[model samples]
Target: MTPPISRSHPGLRAVFELAEFLDHGQKLPEQSRSLLAQALQECIADGFDTSLFTALGITQWGGVPAVKKIGLLRRDRVLRRLRSRIPEWASLSPNAAAKEMSASFRRYETTRWPRERHSAKGPAAQPNSIWWGLLRSELGVPGEKRLAQILKAEIQDGFEFPKGPATVAGTGEHPENTGTNIR
Candidate 1:
Protein backbone atom coordinates (compact mmCIF):
# COMPACT_ATOMS: atom_id res chain seq x y z
CA MET A 1 0.00 0.00 0.00
CA THR A 2 1.10 3.57 -0.64
CA PRO A 3 1.36 6.42 1.87
CA PRO A 4 -1.35 9.05 2.09
CA ILE A 5 -1.01 12.43 0.37
CA SER A 6 -0.83 15.43 2.67
CA ARG A 7 -0.37 19.15 2.37
CA SER A 8 1.43 19.32 5.68
CA HIS A 9 4.77 21.06 5.42
CA PRO A 10 7.86 19.49 6.95
CA GLY A 11 8.46 22.60 9.04
CA LEU A 12 5.20 22.13 10.89
CA ARG A 13 6.63 20.38 13.93
CA ALA A 14 3.70 21.05 16.21
CA VAL A 15 1.26 19.54 13.78
CA PHE A 16 3.34 16.40 13.35
CA GLU A 17 3.88 16.00 17.09
CA LEU A 18 0.15 16.39 17.56
CA ALA A 19 -0.37 13.67 15.00
CA GLU A 20 1.86 11.45 17.07
CA PHE A 21 -0.16 12.30 20.16
CA LEU A 22 -3.31 11.08 18.51
CA ASP A 23 -1.61 8.00 17.12
CA HIS A 24 -0.41 7.10 20.58
CA GLY A 25 -3.67 7.94 22.36
CA GLN A 26 -1.94 10.47 24.59
CA LYS A 27 -3.68 13.49 26.08
CA LEU A 28 -2.39 16.99 26.53
CA PRO A 29 -3.08 19.82 28.93
CA GLU A 30 -6.80 20.43 29.37
CA GLN A 31 -6.56 24.00 28.13
CA SER A 32 -4.89 22.95 24.85
CA ARG A 33 -7.80 20.89 23.53
CA SER A 34 -8.67 23.34 20.78
CA LEU A 35 -5.12 23.48 19.53
CA LEU A 36 -5.12 19.69 19.59
CA ALA A 37 -8.45 19.76 17.81
CA GLN A 38 -6.94 22.01 15.18
CA ALA A 39 -4.05 19.63 14.64
CA LEU A 40 -6.29 16.56 14.49
CA GLN A 41 -8.43 18.41 11.97
CA GLU A 42 -5.39 19.08 9.81
CA CYS A 43 -4.35 15.45 9.87
CA ILE A 44 -7.88 14.28 9.08
CA ALA A 45 -7.88 16.62 6.09
CA ASP A 46 -4.53 15.23 4.99
CA GLY A 47 -5.94 11.68 4.76
CA PHE A 48 -5.06 10.59 8.25
CA ASP A 49 -7.54 8.88 10.58
CA THR A 50 -7.70 11.09 13.66
CA SER A 51 -10.90 10.64 15.61
CA LEU A 52 -9.09 11.04 18.90
CA PHE A 53 -9.69 14.69 19.69
CA THR A 54 -12.70 16.95 19.56
CA ALA A 55 -12.93 17.96 15.89
CA LEU A 56 -13.67 21.64 16.31
CA GLY A 57 -11.61 24.67 15.26
CA ILE A 58 -11.96 28.44 15.08
CA THR A 59 -13.65 29.35 11.83
CA GLN A 60 -11.98 32.76 11.99
CA TRP A 61 -8.68 31.33 10.75
CA GLY A 62 -10.21 31.50 7.27
CA GLY A 63 -8.68 28.27 5.91
CA VAL A 64 -5.07 28.19 7.05
CA PRO A 65 -4.18 26.02 10.01
CA ALA A 66 -2.86 27.72 13.12
CA VAL A 67 -0.25 25.80 15.09
CA LYS A 68 -0.49 27.44 18.52
CA LYS A 69 -3.47 29.73 18.81
CA ILE A 70 -5.82 29.08 21.72
CA GLY A 71 -9.07 31.05 21.74
CA LEU A 72 -10.99 32.52 18.86
CA LEU A 73 -9.20 35.77 18.02
CA ARG A 74 -11.94 37.55 16.12
CA ARG A 75 -14.72 37.11 18.60
CA ASP A 76 -17.24 39.46 16.99
CA ARG A 77 -17.29 37.98 13.51
CA VAL A 78 -17.04 34.34 14.59
CA LEU A 79 -19.82 34.88 17.10
CA ARG A 80 -21.85 36.55 14.37
CA ARG A 81 -21.49 33.54 12.10
CA LEU A 82 -22.40 31.21 14.95
CA ARG A 83 -25.51 33.26 15.77
CA SER A 84 -26.53 33.48 12.12
CA ARG A 85 -26.36 29.70 11.84
CA ILE A 86 -28.59 28.85 14.82
CA PRO A 87 -31.65 27.90 12.80
CA GLU A 88 -29.50 26.06 10.29
CA TRP A 89 -27.76 24.26 13.14
CA ALA A 90 -30.91 23.35 15.04
CA SER A 91 -32.73 21.99 12.03
CA LEU A 92 -30.20 19.35 11.10
CA SER A 93 -30.90 15.68 11.80
CA PRO A 94 -28.41 13.81 14.01
CA ASN A 95 -26.27 12.55 11.16
CA ALA A 96 -26.55 15.81 9.27
CA ALA A 97 -25.56 17.74 12.34
CA ALA A 98 -22.41 15.67 12.68
CA LYS A 99 -21.59 16.24 9.04
CA GLU A 100 -22.37 19.94 9.31
CA MET A 101 -20.43 20.43 12.53
CA SER A 102 -17.39 18.75 11.05
CA ALA A 103 -17.88 20.77 7.91
CA SER A 104 -17.84 23.97 9.91
CA PHE A 105 -14.07 23.55 9.77
CA ARG A 106 -14.16 21.79 6.42
CA ARG A 107 -16.03 24.70 4.83
CA TYR A 108 -12.88 26.75 5.35
CA GLU A 109 -10.40 23.90 4.94
CA THR A 110 -11.52 23.22 1.39
CA THR A 111 -10.79 26.81 0.36
CA ARG A 112 -7.13 26.41 1.30
CA TRP A 113 -6.68 22.86 0.12
CA PRO A 114 -9.15 22.51 -2.70
CA ARG A 115 -8.74 18.78 -3.24
CA GLU A 116 -8.96 17.86 0.43
CA ARG A 117 -12.07 16.01 1.40
CA HIS A 118 -12.85 13.33 3.97
CA SER A 119 -15.84 11.32 5.18
CA ALA A 120 -14.93 12.04 8.81
CA LYS A 121 -17.82 13.78 10.52
CA GLY A 122 -17.44 15.30 13.95
CA PRO A 123 -19.72 14.95 16.96
CA ALA A 124 -22.74 17.22 17.10
CA ALA A 125 -22.24 20.77 18.37
CA GLN A 126 -25.25 21.28 20.63
CA PRO A 127 -24.27 18.76 23.28
CA ASN A 128 -20.60 19.67 23.17
CA SER A 129 -19.61 22.36 25.64
CA ILE A 130 -16.78 23.58 23.45
CA TRP A 131 -19.32 24.43 20.79
CA TRP A 132 -21.78 25.87 23.25
CA GLY A 133 -19.19 27.99 25.05
CA LEU A 134 -17.86 29.40 21.83
CA LEU A 135 -21.36 29.97 20.47
CA ARG A 136 -22.75 31.66 23.60
CA SER A 137 -19.56 33.49 24.59
CA GLU A 138 -20.93 36.77 23.35
CA LEU A 139 -24.27 36.49 25.11
CA GLY A 140 -22.98 37.47 28.58
CA VAL A 141 -23.78 33.98 29.77
CA PRO A 142 -22.47 33.03 33.15
CA GLY A 143 -19.13 31.29 32.83
CA GLU A 144 -20.30 28.56 35.18
CA LYS A 145 -22.95 27.24 32.79
CA ARG A 146 -22.15 23.68 31.68
CA LEU A 147 -23.12 21.99 28.41
CA ALA A 148 -26.18 20.40 30.00
CA GLN A 149 -27.40 23.82 31.13
CA ILE A 150 -26.74 25.39 27.76
CA LEU A 151 -28.35 22.46 25.99
CA LYS A 152 -31.36 22.70 28.25
CA ALA A 153 -31.66 26.36 27.37
CA GLU A 154 -31.34 25.57 23.70
CA ILE A 155 -34.05 22.92 24.04
CA GLN A 156 -36.30 25.28 25.97
CA ASP A 157 -35.90 27.77 23.18
CA GLY A 158 -36.95 25.16 20.58
CA PHE A 159 -33.46 24.15 19.52
CA GLU A 160 -33.63 20.51 20.56
CA PHE A 161 -30.79 18.30 19.27
CA PRO A 162 -29.84 14.63 19.46
CA LYS A 163 -27.64 13.33 22.22
CA GLY A 164 -24.62 11.08 21.91
CA PRO A 165 -25.24 7.36 22.38
CA ALA A 166 -25.46 6.21 25.99
CA THR A 167 -23.69 2.96 25.13
CA VAL A 168 -20.35 4.76 24.95
CA ALA A 169 -20.65 6.10 28.47
CA GLY A 170 -17.15 6.73 29.87
CA THR A 171 -15.81 3.41 28.71
CA GLY A 172 -13.18 4.95 26.44
CA GLU A 173 -13.84 2.04 24.12
CA HIS A 174 -14.51 3.79 20.81
CA PRO A 175 -12.10 6.21 19.24
CA GLU A 176 -14.84 8.35 17.68
CA ASN A 177 -16.34 8.94 21.08
CA THR A 178 -13.01 9.70 22.77
CA GLY A 179 -13.63 13.30 23.71
CA THR A 180 -17.27 12.83 24.56
CA ASN A 181 -18.97 12.11 27.89
CA ILE A 182 -22.21 10.41 26.90
CA ARG A 183 -23.31 9.45 30.38
Candidate 2:
Protein backbone atom coordinates (compact mmCIF):
# COMPACT_ATOMS: atom_id res chain seq x y z
CA MET A 1 0.00 0.00 0.00
CA THR A 2 1.14 3.58 -0.62
CA PRO A 3 1.96 5.70 2.36
CA PRO A 4 -0.07 8.84 2.92
CA ILE A 5 1.29 12.10 1.56
CA SER A 6 2.89 14.31 4.16
CA ARG A 7 1.67 17.88 4.66
CA SER A 8 4.78 19.21 3.00
CA HIS A 9 4.27 17.13 -0.12
CA PRO A 10 2.49 19.90 -2.02
CA GLY A 11 5.04 22.55 -1.17
CA LEU A 12 7.95 20.25 -1.92
CA ARG A 13 6.33 19.22 -5.16
CA ALA A 14 5.74 22.86 -6.10
CA VAL A 15 9.38 23.67 -5.52
CA PHE A 16 10.53 21.26 -8.20
CA GLU A 17 7.70 22.06 -10.56
CA LEU A 18 8.47 25.75 -10.44
CA ALA A 19 12.17 25.12 -10.84
CA GLU A 20 11.59 23.00 -13.92
CA PHE A 21 9.28 25.61 -15.36
CA LEU A 22 11.78 28.39 -14.84
CA ASP A 23 14.64 26.28 -16.13
CA HIS A 24 12.92 25.81 -19.45
CA GLY A 25 13.24 29.60 -19.88
CA GLN A 26 10.27 29.48 -22.21
CA LYS A 27 7.01 31.32 -21.76
CA LEU A 28 5.13 30.26 -18.67
CA PRO A 29 2.29 28.10 -19.91
CA GLU A 30 -0.98 29.26 -18.36
CA GLN A 31 -2.22 25.83 -17.32
CA SER A 32 1.03 24.67 -15.70
CA ARG A 33 1.59 28.14 -14.26
CA SER A 34 -1.78 28.21 -12.57
CA LEU A 35 -1.30 24.73 -11.20
CA LEU A 36 2.11 25.65 -9.80
CA ALA A 37 0.79 28.89 -8.35
CA GLN A 38 -1.95 27.04 -6.53
CA ALA A 39 0.46 24.48 -5.18
CA LEU A 40 2.83 27.15 -3.87
CA GLN A 41 0.08 29.18 -2.19
CA GLU A 42 -1.52 26.08 -0.77
CA CYS A 43 1.80 25.04 0.62
CA ILE A 44 1.84 28.19 2.73
CA ALA A 45 -1.76 27.87 3.86
CA ASP A 46 -1.61 24.15 4.51
CA GLY A 47 1.56 23.79 6.56
CA PHE A 48 5.23 24.50 7.10
CA ASP A 49 7.09 23.83 3.90
CA THR A 50 10.73 24.05 4.90
CA SER A 51 11.31 21.09 2.64
CA LEU A 52 10.31 23.27 -0.30
CA PHE A 53 13.15 25.73 0.28
CA THR A 54 15.57 22.90 0.92
CA ALA A 55 14.90 21.54 -2.53
CA LEU A 56 15.71 24.96 -4.03
CA GLY A 57 19.18 24.71 -2.46
CA ILE A 58 19.46 28.44 -1.63
CA THR A 59 21.31 27.88 1.62
CA GLN A 60 23.90 30.60 1.24
CA TRP A 61 22.04 33.01 3.55
CA GLY A 62 21.74 30.42 6.26
CA GLY A 63 18.19 29.76 7.50
CA VAL A 64 16.11 32.66 6.27
CA PRO A 65 12.71 31.33 5.28
CA ALA A 66 12.43 31.55 1.51
CA VAL A 67 10.16 34.41 0.40
CA LYS A 68 9.43 35.65 -3.13
CA LYS A 69 9.62 39.46 -2.96
CA ILE A 70 12.91 39.50 -1.17
CA GLY A 71 14.20 36.85 -3.55
CA LEU A 72 13.23 38.97 -6.55
CA LEU A 73 14.85 42.17 -5.29
CA ARG A 74 18.01 41.24 -7.06
CA ARG A 75 19.91 44.54 -7.53
CA ASP A 76 16.79 46.61 -7.09
CA ARG A 77 17.15 50.07 -5.56
CA VAL A 78 14.62 49.36 -2.87
CA LEU A 79 16.29 46.16 -1.81
CA ARG A 80 19.68 47.76 -1.92
CA ARG A 81 18.52 50.58 0.31
CA LEU A 82 17.01 48.21 2.82
CA ARG A 83 20.03 45.96 2.69
CA SER A 84 22.28 48.95 3.20
CA ARG A 85 20.67 49.40 6.58
CA ILE A 86 21.70 45.95 7.71
CA PRO A 87 24.23 47.49 10.04
CA GLU A 88 21.61 49.66 11.68
CA TRP A 89 18.84 47.10 11.87
CA ALA A 90 21.08 44.31 12.98
CA SER A 91 22.05 46.40 16.00
CA LEU A 92 18.58 45.96 17.48
CA SER A 93 17.72 42.89 19.52
CA PRO A 94 18.62 39.85 17.48
CA ASN A 95 15.23 38.25 17.99
CA ALA A 96 13.38 41.42 17.03
CA ALA A 97 15.61 42.00 14.02
CA ALA A 98 15.15 38.48 12.80
CA LYS A 99 11.40 38.69 13.23
CA GLU A 100 11.24 41.82 11.13
CA MET A 101 13.57 40.37 8.54
CA SER A 102 11.37 37.33 8.14
CA ALA A 103 8.33 39.55 7.74
CA SER A 104 10.06 41.63 5.11
CA PHE A 105 11.11 38.55 3.25
CA ARG A 106 7.54 37.21 3.25
CA ARG A 107 5.75 40.45 2.45
CA TYR A 108 5.56 40.08 -1.33
CA GLU A 109 5.80 36.35 -1.93
CA THR A 110 2.12 35.87 -2.54
CA THR A 111 1.53 38.98 -4.59
CA ARG A 112 4.35 38.72 -7.12
CA TRP A 113 3.99 36.67 -10.27
CA PRO A 114 5.45 33.21 -9.85
CA ARG A 115 7.78 33.63 -12.80
CA GLU A 116 9.14 37.02 -11.73
CA ARG A 117 9.45 35.90 -8.15
CA HIS A 118 11.96 33.25 -9.17
CA SER A 119 13.85 35.49 -11.62
CA ALA A 120 17.34 36.59 -10.47
CA LYS A 121 21.07 36.33 -11.16
CA GLY A 122 23.85 34.36 -9.50
CA PRO A 123 25.55 37.33 -7.84
CA ALA A 124 22.33 39.01 -6.74
CA ALA A 125 20.88 36.01 -4.90
CA GLN A 126 19.07 37.41 -1.87
CA PRO A 127 17.85 34.78 0.57
CA ASN A 128 21.12 33.86 2.21
CA SER A 129 23.31 36.86 1.59
CA ILE A 130 20.72 39.29 2.93
CA TRP A 131 20.38 37.28 6.12
CA TRP A 132 24.12 37.15 6.52
CA GLY A 133 24.59 40.82 5.69
CA LEU A 134 22.09 41.84 8.31
CA LEU A 135 23.79 39.82 10.99
CA ARG A 136 27.29 40.80 9.97
CA SER A 137 26.24 44.43 9.79
CA GLU A 138 25.20 44.52 13.42
CA LEU A 139 26.07 42.76 16.63
CA GLY A 140 23.32 40.22 16.03
CA VAL A 141 24.08 36.81 14.62
CA PRO A 142 22.17 35.10 11.87
CA GLY A 143 20.59 31.78 12.84
CA GLU A 144 23.15 29.81 10.89
CA LYS A 145 26.11 31.48 12.59
CA ARG A 146 24.60 31.46 16.05
CA LEU A 147 24.05 27.76 15.70
CA ALA A 148 27.50 27.35 14.26
CA GLN A 149 29.31 29.25 17.03
CA ILE A 150 28.21 26.44 19.30
CA LEU A 151 29.19 23.71 16.88
CA LYS A 152 31.31 22.07 19.53
CA ALA A 153 28.02 21.52 21.34
CA GLU A 154 25.87 20.97 18.19
CA ILE A 155 25.81 21.59 14.42
CA GLN A 156 23.80 22.60 11.22
CA ASP A 157 21.55 24.17 7.13
CA GLY A 158 19.06 27.31 2.66
CA PHE A 159 16.12 29.58 -0.17
CA GLU A 160 15.02 31.21 -3.75
CA PHE A 161 17.74 31.38 -6.40
CA PRO A 162 17.25 31.39 -10.18
CA LYS A 163 20.24 29.55 -11.59
CA GLY A 164 19.25 26.27 -10.05
CA PRO A 165 20.31 22.64 -10.74
CA ALA A 166 20.65 23.02 -14.51
CA THR A 167 22.76 26.18 -14.60
CA VAL A 168 25.06 24.94 -11.88
CA ALA A 169 25.92 21.84 -13.85
CA GLY A 170 26.52 23.96 -16.93
CA THR A 171 29.02 26.25 -15.19
CA GLY A 172 31.68 23.51 -15.47
CA GLU A 173 33.73 25.47 -12.96
CA HIS A 174 33.67 22.51 -10.57
CA PRO A 175 34.34 18.89 -11.43
CA GLU A 176 30.89 18.24 -9.95
CA ASN A 177 28.17 20.75 -9.07
CA THR A 178 27.31 19.15 -5.77
CA GLY A 179 26.88 22.02 -3.32
CA THR A 180 23.40 23.09 -2.26
CA ASN A 181 23.87 26.88 -2.73
CA ILE A 182 22.46 27.20 -6.27
CA ARG A 183 23.97 30.61 -7.09
TM-scores for every candidate against the unseen true structure: 0.19, 0.24
Clash-forming residue pairs, model 2: 58-159, 59-158, 61-128
Q: Which stretches of candidate 1 lie over 4 Å from their true place?
A: 1-84, 112-183
Candidate 2: tens digits of C-alpha lDDT, residues 1-183: 334323234443354446555555545546546656554565576574533344333322323334432222221221223333566543545445445555554442333323343333222344433332322222222343342222222111022233422222122221122211212
For model 2, what is the alpha-carbon lDDT of residue 55?
37
As a whole number from 0 to 100, the lDDT of residue 85 in candidate 1 is 51
Taken over the whole model, the C-alpha lDDT of each candidate is 0.34, 0.36
Residue 150 in model 1: lDDT: 32
What TM-score does candidate 2 reach?
0.24
- Cα deviation at 137, candidate 1, in Å, is 15
Clashes of 1: 0
